[model samples]
Target chain A: MAKKKKAFDKLQWIAAYKSFVLEKGELPATVRELAEMAGQTFPDFKKQFTDLRQLETAVIALYFKEANDLLMADEKFEEYSNKEKQLAFLYVMIEKAGADEVFLQEFQRLKKTDRGFAVRLMRFLNRQELSWAELSWGASTAERVGVNPKQAALIQHALSTLMFFLKDYSEEKQDTDAYIEKTTDVLYRLTDTSTVRSMVDLGKFLFSRRKTTFSWE
Target chain B: MGQDKIAVSKYQRAGKLVNTGAKVGANYMKHYAKKLTGSKATKQDLEEENAKDDYSAFSELKGGPLKVAQMLSMGDQVLPKAYVDQFALAQNQVTPLSLPLVRKTFRKYFEKDPLQLFDEFSTEAVNAASIGQVHKGRKGKQEFAIKIQYPGVADSLQSDLRLIAPIATRFLGLKKKEVAPYFEEVERKLMEETDYRKELQNANEIISGCGNLEGIHFPEFDPQLSTDRIITMTWLKGLSLNDWLATDPSQEDRNRIGQLLWDFYQHQFHLLRVIHADPHPGNFIITPENELGVIDFGCIKHIPSDFYASYEKLMRSGQEQDSPELIDALFALELLHDGDSEKDQATIMGVFGSMFQLVGQPFYSETFDFSNDSFFEKIYSTGMALSKDSSYRNLSARGSRHFIYFNRTYFGLYQLLHQLKANIHTGQWTFIAA
Candidate 1:
């Protein structure tokens, strides 16, 4: 009974995290405030995390975890190729984010203002990259591909690029669908031809360095 | 196909129409001016000049204007032989959307370059039509034919029809109100044709309806690759009727292929009351094995139950030698209206009723030989004489609106089988209502 209560409590805070972002147009000003808004105390909020910054990181982490859970629950996931799995991941993430235009815009604005916010984005990218690598290479093939920083960076760049489009995608999302299909195709091609020569060329001058110039794909 | 981009903008399209109208007006003024000056410009000279301008305008502006031109060109009762022959070429001469425009169209609906969707996608269109163009594509081991519609065709068809109404009225010698029904019918079908999603639905319905049948094939449509303006389907393998004819197939081959077409139409019209409306030679492919391959479900006509029953009544009246009954059927079908005097009604019935007799002749016979040269000669000459007749011209310039596609399909079939020089079992529809 106590374990079930704890799980339910965690869910309440997650739901509160989403509603707070949606209603207040931002995360709580502080953990105590979040606790107060969620109808909990600071001690209770601290049980889940050490600080407000960790809670913010958890909010981003929750999105990926939910998407990954969906991927696992899907019966057809095993039938898809590694590239297809990555594409499926994108669709799942977009669906779960449920973050509408205002949420996306506010997050984007926050991105521009907060330098520390870059660390949260990097964490998100790293998690996505690891998920992609694990699905794409599996345990046996992953060692053959090696732990090349360039390969990791290329995926990071690709995910970061995809997020930018997903953030600004209109309600119809016809443009976003095209962007996902096209960018993933380019990523698949780059990964398939990942060799010493390709990796060297990629790493030498920001290989997979999507022009730092930001634009919707 | 011309290298120039298709005119999609309403203003640019209107500009083309205005230019055509200006030329026609200028030609008329020149004819009068020549007469006033006592120049030696014959009526034939003036006609040829106007025909040139009309063809250039309709054929050059290749969307709804060109489609209207093709319809008018096929109207034996409307255009002069010279104009008909000239405008018929408009069906062949079309301006394709450029590569950049095709890509842009794909992006608008699909949000991806077509190249990214398929392993191989042709840059140039293989077949370009008034509403869309088709490209060859391949994904993995599968081949596909992807159709990309010109942007804004759905929005522009209405305005285009409005602009062409007056011009079609003058050439066809009809009042504006009389011409409105024909253009409205054409517009309704054109709007449906421009919608690829609807075409996809039609394709599925047709495939299901015809699945168990032999000697006919409908391409498999991929919903994943299809949108409102774009459709990707499994590529059909066969030769177009003209290309197949060029290969000099045997008489047996011709007869076999012709029979497939005949039976297909009979089944659709009599049982289903639905027929493929656009039946030009391009929409049919005569396989090397003498089977028929039907493509382009873009335009389909569903004959209402009452209309079909009344049409059958007209045929039955013709069969029973009941002139009064035949006249009543015509009126019921809206072929002949209420206002005509008895004498005018008789003359109108005599003219159109004879045309119906010729159309019904095949069904009356056990097997009909389309290779009868004199029979075809009579069809053409009689059509020209009836169209050229002054008495018929005085009648209203409309018939049953369904007659537009009803006549198109039968006439197109007659012309096609005649070209094939085949003998067919036209007796299939005799027991249809049974």
Candidate 2:
């Protein structure tokens, strides 16, 4: 009789990989260790990913890939404005990465202790995010707007909001909705005239001692 | 042409206000100067001309000025009827963002094109309001009415209101001090309205609060698709009051619809003490079944327990016609001061008594027929007479500032009921035991 197959799909494998790195506080050195963390054997892990390095790379790509899948699965995604698609993309990634206090703490710890690993991880993340920005926003529009600055600002914004969310998000209660709104504000301010104007006003307010009184006309 | 985006900058908003103020001032000066020079215009004609200028300037403004315009239009004592008629347009006849600009706004809010978010999002807006415009959209099988606020509305609200305060008080026919609390109340509620997430929370609470009430319905709000500036709720199918009236439904139809509205306010006030305060005709819809569909929760007002208790007591005093009880109630409401002289106290009561009498009229009846043109005419005439009465004019805004909204709510309800000509059973919520 044929051997029983493991239930480890690509998404499950990605989840297992994330948990393995985050729980172990480092990348898994071997497939056996990753499989053990995933509650499967080495053979089961090999069926999904070839090696530890490949699995790590897949984990990064999977963030956007899975997010894209979600966007596609949502019938309304195509009908949404470009901004909404971008927000939905970011939300799905953050949610998939397990936007919780524990995840935030572990990630912070990894960044502090393992400089080389953090650099490699962030480089991959930055690359994937840029690709998404270009894809979701459309190449022509993204090109005109200079996708790099927008992408960089958005990534930094997403991280900053995650840190803020960690302050309030806990095991017993998670205010992801609030975090989504706060983070979305950054995107809005960056792109919309109103929010951008407010940002400029805020900057002026901070810099000037006297309050500015502009005309109502 | 101006910035290619909704000019939500405080400087821009203030600029608009200043320019409008200057123009209005110039017109007033010119009118007086013209009158002194023996022009053919009567005071009524001059008033009409001034009203025209005020409307043109205020109607161009998108945020605070328009909100104040709507509020002033609701009060009979606040503005001349011509000005009120012009300001009434501010409630529903708002300019819309261009399609490209609309797409840009969506892009800013969602970071994706709106087309990619909904299954079928209309580029054309179905309706527009002072704060935002509404678009019809579909996600799979479900339809939604997505309200997207004009950009920068929330960010610039404080500054806009600051600029509007002096100008608005003059328009509302109240002293700055007298109107401050009401402005604060409006500011608080308007701030909440800009935050769609808060509206979502309010919607859920209101749904639960009024879920058991018959003949009233609320749309299901989708949190996943909602943001502070953008709200997505299930599409409520119905006609606005004007549209329904044009269709000429039967008197029985009108009464059922009217009863639905009455019960909604009564249930909300006596039990919840939380009201959907913006009862502007645009905020409600009459379904094919004559059910009342409440669409906006942007201006939900929660009455303080003390205020509710005191107001209830005042109503009771009116019912019993007890002078001492009325005085006690006014004191409780903080409308009457302990330091007031006996003569001043009597003057306050004399002014408030007429106002209270009009307010209490419906409550004294078993079934009040609002369709009686005479009832509304009497109320309006009394309001005009009292406002002109030098003694009443001297009475500063007394009582809790909450009464501003409290009175506005009943006035709005009464106005709509009168339009519908529905006979409603009143005196039912005469007492609140709690």
Candidate 3:
């Protein structure tokens, strides 16, 4: 029997895969080649990743994982409002991706090969539910309960930010930073219901103050 | 905290100006409509209404127009009293950046959150600067004040001025061509004010040059913690000049502080030849020990050698109504044009001569009492007369571009002293022979 294969850490394999791609400027042609380059046996590599496609997906997932881990590591992360939490995540991720030219180039190639890659990746990242406030409207009894609207918004924001980051060429990507700040502000403001409440209040005030006129017809 | 978004885009800012213009136009129409019916409304009433609308618009659009309003109001000679009173409120009405935006700016420059960089950082701003906001932070035993510039202020400045040009031309009742050079000078200085690195350099220069001036204090800046948009400096604990005045200090203490202020400006003007052009009360602080704390060094004007020589000559030729030397100096200073007809030249000289005599009174004497309200009243009446004089208005703004901030410095300094009501020896500087 073949020697019992050692347990292989997925993150270690992803790191090795990244170094292999960066050094050679291309992905290995086969899992065997990647495993050999990483100085690991095929059996151990197979235990961690089924094929090159899985490994490739894992690499992109690792980026998001690391960004999330960094955000979670911050002591103030728990205290931040949901909007701030989203902003911090975008800032951290964009800054990290911008600094890694090699990764960005690889990401571009992957995007060309798979048009749905970003959407699928965003969906995967959005699996974890956030504790967002819910909206409800009723008079004593609940008539309608609003679902959390942040999931779709955050996914859309993340994807657009990634696309913007790829094209942003401002010095130190400052324009991208400004874009993120402005868009995030507008997005959160759009979701806030205070404007709608104020509009209703204004409408009631106008109706109450309406002038009643009597004319002989 | 609630985010109060400042109008940053050129279009949004321009739209605000358009609104003000329409409102002002409406006010004029109303005034005329009332006048046609033989109503008792006067032009002064119209002016007061216009000034209120203009200030409301400027205060909303904070960066450039409000700054121009403040500068126009500072001289108290250029604008009517109603306008001066209304625009003076722009000094403290700047909107502050939100906490998230502040964090974003910090991350952009330092690649770390402000909380991570400092041992303790306040989420809320302590005070608002013209182009930025200041937050208090502490590291171990040392306290700091960090000024963070609002986003896109520098980029939007040109467009802001472009939008304000037509409005200013109409408001100041000057031809657009006449306002161009002065606006250009103001635009250049406003651009410089946006660069915190230049402010850092200015602070360092002033501190090194006047470090030994008694009873005057400058903050210690940390370059390592500073960036192009964020300035980190040691916090100077004190009340603003207005606040200090409200404390009901003794006349002796007031005179002491006033003397220090006078000497500070004199030293910078004469010896260093580079003066802090912004002498607004907000830039000053009175320490607990009654020492003067110069908090801001954002607007430093380096007097040109030629301008200085001519200015010195003009001051020395004082009380001589039409001496050739005085005319020559005035010509050199660009206050009188060579193309002016003899009558216009004489009229201009007579006006400037008396104006200079009254303005230069403090410098011409060993001691002067600023508490004498009649003196200020005379200066105000002279200014009002000049504003109303159709002959003076016909002549375009004749002085060199340097005169804009230079006159502002003196006017602001005089106003500060007047507010203090402090009598002190004013002829202490050697540049002027009393």
Candidate 4:
């Protein structure tokens, strides 16, 4: 999320994009096509934008906007700690805004000969996801989980794998039942603490809903 | 002994053995590689290399250790169908060891005859292992498994490593300074493998260190019968996870076994502070109840306290885009080096970095599912790529480090579990990490 002028006329650009799309409503476009739509010369367009996804990324700011508004509108997400509340806020925002679908369609359009939005989409999800879920397991989580740092990292690594698997899975909604089921299965066996209830449980619920998956064999 | 045998002098015999063994090795891998990748390759090409290697080793493969080395290394990656078809037909493939050689191994390592100790010694080998053959016998009421070293195996190792060095380097692209760490690590492990006494010590340490771990089994040692060349452990029986998984076990079965395997490794990597570094399938047995039986402590890989700690940091740093600092730390830890040229270093880094990302992915997971073929493929393909780099022209003498055996062992074991589709959360990693 970069700062834009408070009174900048972004709507005007959107209107222009719509007009362009009216005649050029293809699934996605290459850098050449995007340059043509924007009424800019190819060389200048390439200079202005390193990739076509830069344009799509500019538009993706809208989803983040929707997410932010949803977060501001909801108060229950505020009841948790800084980390949990942040995750809860993002979870609710994405769910309410159909964030996954919007981003998927946007990404499909932006993925061309070279410009890939998958990493950008990942960067966005990662930016907003607001959980250490994707990061390597470190001392803090290891202590909380009662495993050595390496083993903790390994477990966390497994969770991250399921996250990647979810990205490639073709399904409706998200599921964390199995993730929770699987997580708690290992969690309970290792430690007797109930402290991971909210954090681990929430991760399970959201991630498992999308389809808890990945083949190890 | 026959006096009519060619009277090649000691140097001549050594030269012949070394050359023959080297050619045999070179030919086997080339032939095995062709057979495994048989798209454009023909039976003639396959047999041609096999013959070349066999012809080279013809003078030395006479009941020596090279035969077993061939078998184990062949099992490494997927062997081509043609090679399997060709080799499978040669049923009694390995050189048959003479009774005198077995007696001599006992006499040299332990001042006794093997048959003098065991209640009944089978003159015939029951099954062939990577570097040895198994003989069945009974001591009191217990059935036993005896792993007998091939005669002159000790003599074969240096030559094998020499022949293996150049190709292995090309396979992995290891450089000079890099060679010392890798081979130092490998030699240390290899030494334990050669010295059955050290392996016996390893077996005792691990069994006692892992005392009464539920679902874990260790064979009782008999010092009266053990020796430097032969290790006699109680013969245990069960289905390998490979065989078990092939039957398409339920997720419950997979998870149970996966968890056990994970827990066992965690214990070794952490508390015992020593690892049973061998990844050979024969080292493990998975039972009907999902119990894991680990044997063969001969291939033990050791980690200094500081090295393990540094390695833990390295594993953690690898999770993010932290290569610069990671490289620095790795250099500090001697895991990576500027040993080769700058370009070569960068190329090796790029190759290994990608693999680190893949292998390290499970570090972020709740638990890695060993059965995932895609995950396995990612790591395996990356490894194959890493091995094929020209920058590692001298890997054998350079890259064969002790620290690397852990990674190699795990890679091999994980491939087996990957096929089984086991979903082990490895709960005990948490306990060990604690």
Candidate 5:
């Protein structure tokens, strides 16, 4: 009779996967190898993940989830403005990523070999970020006319920041921190309705003046 | 309203200073154009325009260049009133670090969030320091003032000074070689100011040295809680000197506060040899008990024995205009260089002689009335006359690097006293001639 199949939790598989990538300096060639490294059966690994790619996506998503969980745990998180929430999330995510250098290294390496996987991971992350942004902005404001553009800009910002973080070599990655602060500040300023409102006011004045000039002509 | 975010990148900061240079060049072009058109644009008008442009840029940069501007403004004798007026504004307009950034800095230094370390930490900065912002924090019954340095300030300082050097030389009307030492001096002090650990050590040294001095107070620093980028000290409860002056304190009160200020500086200069060289009003506080509070020890200048000897001689001989001893001391201090021609020497001696005599008047007296408008008028006119004098303009910069901060210290002290309108005894220090 075959040995009884032991059930392994998803987190245990993730923990095993992260250490394998860190130690071997590459992802396991097959799920069987990862399960064997973790002293578990291949069926147990298959129970948690469909493939190594799915496992990779889950590992990346775990960073986001952990970052979000940390932010949500903060009592002040609820009181934060939308901009502050976004900033807090970025800072916390970078911090989380910083703590897991092996995972980031592997993620960067995977991006070079598997562009499709990188895209999928980014879309997954973006969806998570967008939902958070919507929650912060409230459904009503999130559905407003200009917010979609702002959300699009924010997603692009998040992507660029991730790219920047991968290349950041400053002491304590302070350059990345400063970049996030400055760009987010600019984005919020650009999307601010007051500026749009003023432009509208100017347009009205210009149109009224043009009409009067036409009448005079 | 949100605080203006600081220009953070090296390129961004460098661009701002470069923009000032371009603006100054544009101003000059405009001045000449106005002249070609026979417009009534005097040199003063061009200078005022240049100064305004420079100030706006420095205020925006708000790190090294802004500091240099403040130091230049304090040496009111070297700059025009227009530049002085504009650059003096650099003292107040600093953009604070965001709350998240502040927490990030705290975490970097302390390995924990500010809120985690303190029982109650302020999310908003209570005040802005030159290179950092001050936040109030509390732990149980203990209240603390925490100073958090802006990110990349230290790293960018060297580049900022490099960019400012040429502009500074032009603005001061001196050769690059002539201004190098002063910039070097300012650069060193500014670098030291960015290191909070050094500042904590400086504060401790000053407090221990001047701790026995009457009517003055210092905050107890917490070294365990302090780091290179953040300083945690017991919170000082007081009004800033300017605010204290606003409450319309009596003449006696002003004199008392002024005496304490005078004694505090004199004690540092005479006995300790290391002085809190930054004497700006913001660095000082008048406690609710009306005692003097010295809050910042960031820019402490340690006077070398040789320099202090010459300085002492200069002060003692300053009252004697045209005296050989005074000229000898001036040469010793490098205020009169060996390369100077007789004409240049005479020009420098003539201007600096009368200037020092007036500046040294307080030391000459048992008690000097700082409120005497004529006294400040003489100083201002001497400065104005020196700036306008063509012969003086031709002379190269001829002062020791030490003089940059040394002159700043005295001039700032004089300005503070003048603002206080206090009459205080100045001949009490041990170094003064009997």
Candidate 6:
């Protein structure tokens, strides 16, 4: 991927936020919202980008943060990581826009305000949700320990989810301990053979345990 | 009296004798009454027609648990011999695996034909089980046994079960609030049985659990060949328990082999909460070394946390009989019928108490000599007689959802033991101490 350009200074970044509000017809999202859309504070997120646009460049990133919070609370994601969190967020976004007519309507109403917001939001929406892109996650045997490309990819997907789900994940606090422990387990299992193999039941075991089922219509 | 009244008919007497509550008998009457009264269709005549219908439906469902129907058919033998003869025409005519149906299922699941994936596949099935059939073939250098479940079997499960059940809520009854949990359990276990994936998990878990133990063995799964409808595993060697017993093995050999099954189950309960819930003698094969090769991992019941607590309590009781604890255990299992009368509860408990005594029999002594048919006959006769009691009916519906397979499995194991005439070390081989 080419390095994304068009960096914004703090004020220009503030102006972009203004433009976003002017177009979106909502109050300028709070700094807490700005610093926390990806569930990361601005300082902690700087490794990915130095400028404020890194946070505000994408309007759907804010929406991703809001929905990702809900997905995090779900039982399935009890022990997800940052990469996994992002992919899950992406999946939610795609499934929501593709399948939910009402959500698409609300999104369209906001898009009518400006083409720029519309284009960016549309691109982010479901770019890969229903696609067989994450087939690895869809139908895979247990994760192999250490660094097979498959394991690395799966772990990256998990880590991205954590980075995008739990705000202040790096903060050393008692309350944050739950999130920490969960991510640790998911990460550890990504590298643990017995847990992965046993749970997956390897290549053949997956089929015998499954009932003949048609996908949801 | 001026004139003798017309003699009462024999059919009239039978109508008075049979229970109106038994819908099956009433249904039999209603069907036969038409043909019997009509010159063209007597009761015997109607049975012949019904037999034809049952045969077609059985073939249609692709073997829809017709064995349950077959068992009920045996009970129907008490009817007049002519009626029994007509009913005997019903044959479990299962069709062999057709290449087209096999291809369609493969394409539907994998987006490709089975022939493309599986080379040198067998169209003929070597054996049939409750849910489906198994075909022996080769995927490559590795030999495989591909299992194909009949089509549309899942849709017919509820109707098939309702048709087989002695009493539905319509004949007997259950609480309105209680229906959801009760049927939810039956549907769940049956669904589990339908899922070949769950079976694969069970196969692996069992392989992991007791694979290394001497005189105890099971098959390892090869996953690429498996799907939701089909299970592929490495071909296993040896004859099943029924085959071995038919050969008339010596008492020493029978006892040693029986000990392996007992020990294997014991190891599962203490080491893993999973219980192998299938009891068909064919599932257990005897090898040359006398090692028991257990196949067919289709029905497995994993003991949930709550049930384990009850099990712990039941195991703790020394007298080998504790009514309150057992009821508590049943409660954990969701077995207690919510609106059962005291008489009903006691009768059900009495049945359970007898079985507890039987299972615990081995715990008291060094070994269990199952060659004695009388001991098993007592248990069987007791269960069958208990089953006939009107109030004890619908008890299965009231029982815990998860425990259905587990409970059925114990009866199956005892029956298997009796048939094998195997003597097993019950006290040393199980969780009786715990």
Ranked by DockQ, top first = 5, 3, 2, 1, 6, 4
Q: Write the per-residue lDDT of candidate 5 for residues B260-325, one digit (tens) a residue.
A: 999988888888888999998888889999999998899999988888888888877777777888
Which TM-score values does chain B get in all models?
0.87, 0.90, 0.93, 0.74, 0.90, 0.72
> Could you give me the TM-score of model 1 versus the true structure?
0.62
Q: For residues A1-217, write the lDDT of model 1, one tens digit per residue.
A: 3222332256567767667777787757787777767767777876777776766666665666677677778665666666666666665565566454456556556556677865665554454434444674452324544444543544454446447555643435533544444455556666565587877886766745557534465
Ranking by lDDT: 5, 3, 1, 2, 6, 4
Per-model TM-score of chain A alone? 0.69, 0.54, 0.69, 0.38, 0.76, 0.23
Per-residue alpha-carbon lDDT of candidate 1 for residues B1-434, written as tens digits (9 for 90 to 100): 12443443468778887887799889989998999999988777777788889888776566687777766655433455567667767755665554544555575667887778889988678887777788999999988999887655666677788777776688768888877887788889988988899999888866677766789987899998898889989888889887899999899999998898898888888777788877777778876567889888988888888788778888888754437787788788876778878877778778766776766789889899988877766777788787778888777875778888888878778777877889988875663553
Ten contiguous residues with the weakest lDDT in model 3 chain B: B1-10
- lDDT value for model 5: 0.80
The CA root-mean-square deviation of candidate 2, after full C-alpha superposition on the true structure, stands at: 12.3
What C-alpha lDDT do the candidate models reach, one value each? 0.71, 0.71, 0.78, 0.53, 0.80, 0.54
In model 1, residue pairs whose N, Cα or C atoms come closer than 3 Å (at least 3 residues apart or on different chains), thus clashing, are A202-A207
Cα RMSD of all models vs. native, in order, equals 13.3, 12.3, 6.2, 32.0, 4.0, 20.5
Q: Model 6's chain B TM-score?
A: 0.72
How high is each candidate's TM-score? 0.62, 0.64, 0.78, 0.52, 0.86, 0.52
Ranking 1 against 6 by DockQ, winner: 1
DockQ-based class of model 4: incorrect
Residue-wise C-alpha lDDT for candidate 2, range B166-277, written one tens digit per residue: 8667765779886788788878887888788888888887789999888898899888778877898999888988689889889999888888888899888888889888
Candidate 3, residues A58-173, lDDT tens digits: the string is: 67656556666777687776667666676677776776666676666775764586766665665544453322211111111122233224555665676688777787655555
Candidate 3 global lDDT: 0.78
* lDDT, candidate 4, B125-148, per-residue tens: 766543466777786788888878
What tens digits encode model 3's per-residue C-alpha lDDT throughout B130-189? Answer: 688899999999899999886666766677888888877886688888778998998999
lDDT of 1 at B425: 83
- The candidate that wins on lDDT is 5
Q: What is the lDDT of candidate 1?
A: 0.71
